[model samples]
Target chain A: MVFHYPNGRAYDYHKNENHPSLVNKVNHRSINHNRSKTIYGNRGMSLEEEINESNQYYLSQGIAVIHKKPIPIQIVSVDYPKRSAAVIKEAYFKQASTTDYNGVYKGKYLDFEAKETTNISSFPLRNFHAHQVEHMRACQKQGGICFTIVKFTKTDELFILPADLLFKYWDEQDKSRKSIPKAEIEQLGYKLNYSISPRIPFLKGVDLLIANS
Target chain B: MVFHYPNGRAYDYHKNENHPSLVNKVNHRSINHNRSKTIYGNRGMSLEEEINESNQYYLSQGIAVIHKKPIPIQIVSVDYPKRSAAVIKEAYFKQASTTDYNGVYKGKYLDFEAKETTNISSFPLRNFHAHQVEHMRACQKQGGICFTIVKFTKTDELFILPADLLFKYWDEQDKSRKSIPKAEIEQLGYKLNYSISPRIPFLKGVDLLIANS
Candidate 1:
């Protein structure tokens, strides 16, 4: 079935099935339909998917309001078809200037990025861009709660590292090792395990950060 | 000159000059370069452009970290050339599920949408969508600062209306007039005048909201 938006744009789930983002949304809906079984069984989900599910849970339960920012694309050309939606003919992906997920949590501004690495020893600093780090710093200076969620894929261990501690390693990149060691992250960061409803319960870590601050 | 992003995507300002958003950015840069004269002289600027300029000013001075979210698009297909950036062959614009702008300010979550109308007597209720209203309501419930920046293009007057007041009008749409009268806005909304540096100075209104709340 096709649904038309208020602006007259047609949205066909079947037509958009090939779109990765749309497919993810569809998969999420199916998973949500049988939460008890799929929530714990899905171990192959990406950190981003888990976070998106968690955000949905948070929103449903009135715990928080957060969303992943849409990917930025620079469109060069578009074609207005006679009887269908306008089609973008030429475009390129543009670099994002800020973190992926952000929102209001318990009246505090929350902002963070998520990353998954297969390396067992350390998470490479190259996973983050300079602009994202700078953006987080600016948000932190404005008293927002900023952090990074790093998932070690091999062990399926996830850690929430505060922006201030991330900044220390970011600043030391030029002078020292180009990565944050797993040992150090385990020592300083908050560890989170998978849960039933909100897959990645990172907000528990956020509550800790709020208490410490 | 062409600028290539770290991911090897080429960004040609000359080629993208026709794009409305990029054109706005270029005009904003020119306005920033000659803020003393152009900022006061450019009365033809759109409300979105003005808000973007204000955001840039805020970012430069470390006053806040706000941004206009990118328009979401649903990708259909792409083509990869031998030695160039991958081109999006087909895509469609997706309806946004949230407000246009959001960020952190003074440790609070700020979310808002900007609209301009030529009608001098009243601002039409149709300017906002149900999803956006619902999004704002959710954000407000989560303790975020949510509001609307409405500009009377005919009178060259602007006002920031709080989300709660907007919700009242939205809820009354079926029972009353489909628009909010100018007098009502003037009484309840915070008026804003164009100024130097941050052109729209809407944050002054935000300060009042924060204080009152």
Candidate 2:
């Protein structure tokens, strides 16, 4: 699959290109997405929506109790009719959120960010914020579980990358006009197998990673 | 010792007024002044800053970690220097955060909103959002501790109001022009006494409320 960017560069993910019908033959997983599409719908299915569904499934299965931190919106204009719901006429994006999702699982604090990249060659450093990095670093320092779920949108591949690895790549971006290469990610990152219910298969990788850590 | 508002209403928390002279005050009662200011800086602090400080304290103390969720800010303009941090040229207020603070506290999921009001007659219902109310309700239904800290700015009096009473007032606002009256807050709200550290003393109230519930 090839995606053309605004910069006019064509980036090929090369997913299922070698073997024809590979994508069609394999099933695409679906998350339990329960967020209000009417709210953030136009932005495609948001990360929060996917996580929320995943959390619900996890709760039902007695695995976890994670939830996406609500997006902070600075509502500028609102209209209140005589006797009905208040409508946000005009609102803008506020500051970047602290964590994408947080909860407890087996008496442990779970904090993480979910990001995606269409670019096949590398995951851009710009996809993350400085504060998010700082927050993750702080969490990791405090003996909490901190990681990121990186989705290769074109390949439909997800990886649970550690905060330390993220900081390393982020620091590398400072030295050059380079992103964290796919080769590097494939080496260090834990490849997440997908499924329909939770969709991300993050906890499976988490189990392996936490045990190793 | 009297602090007068624009409406000519005067309130003296009598913190200073109660101390007639240095010798008049009791030594045992005044000894608590040795506590650090940053420890309980929540008093008279903005909601955002207070949550940040509290999170820092939690992080330091190895308490239940809490943090203020960030806003998703979209910048319309920015100034890039030759070699310096980018300066925000133009940005607008984002949306209200999901909740003020959320974290693990004593093996329990804690979530709450912090608000301050200058109004003497009532705490404006406009200070909260429908989504926040709904979120709190959802958290409460799941057996989580959810509440709001309403600070009457002029009086420096803080009240920990549960979501249940808040929802009742919110529902009533549709039929009446009145907000949550101060009298009603006094009747139903738990007064969170100010302490040297974490000036809001919300946890003490949380302990009491959770025990009672």
Identify the candidate with maximal lDDT: 1
lDDT per residue (tens digit) for residues B1-213 in model 1:
123455664433333343333332222322233444533344645466778889999999999999988877777666655565556777776777888899999998999988767698998887788888999999999899999998776567889988888899899999898988889888888999889989989999999889877
Best model per TM-score? 1
- Report the alpha-carbon TM-score of model 1 versus the true structure: 0.82
lDDT tens string, model 2, B1-213?
122334554322223332212111111112223333534434334444444555676666665567765433433333344544334444433344356577766556677887777788788887777767866766665566778878775566788887778889888887886488888888877887656555455777677667766
Over A122-144, each residue of candidate 2 has an lDDT whose tens digit, in order, gives 88877777778877776666556
Best by DockQ: 1
Predictions' DockQ, in order: 0.39, 0.09
Name the runs in model 2 displaced over 4 angstroms: A1-100, A103-110, A115-147, A150-156, A159-213, B1-51
Check candidate 1 and list the clashing pairs.
none
RMSD of 2: 13.8
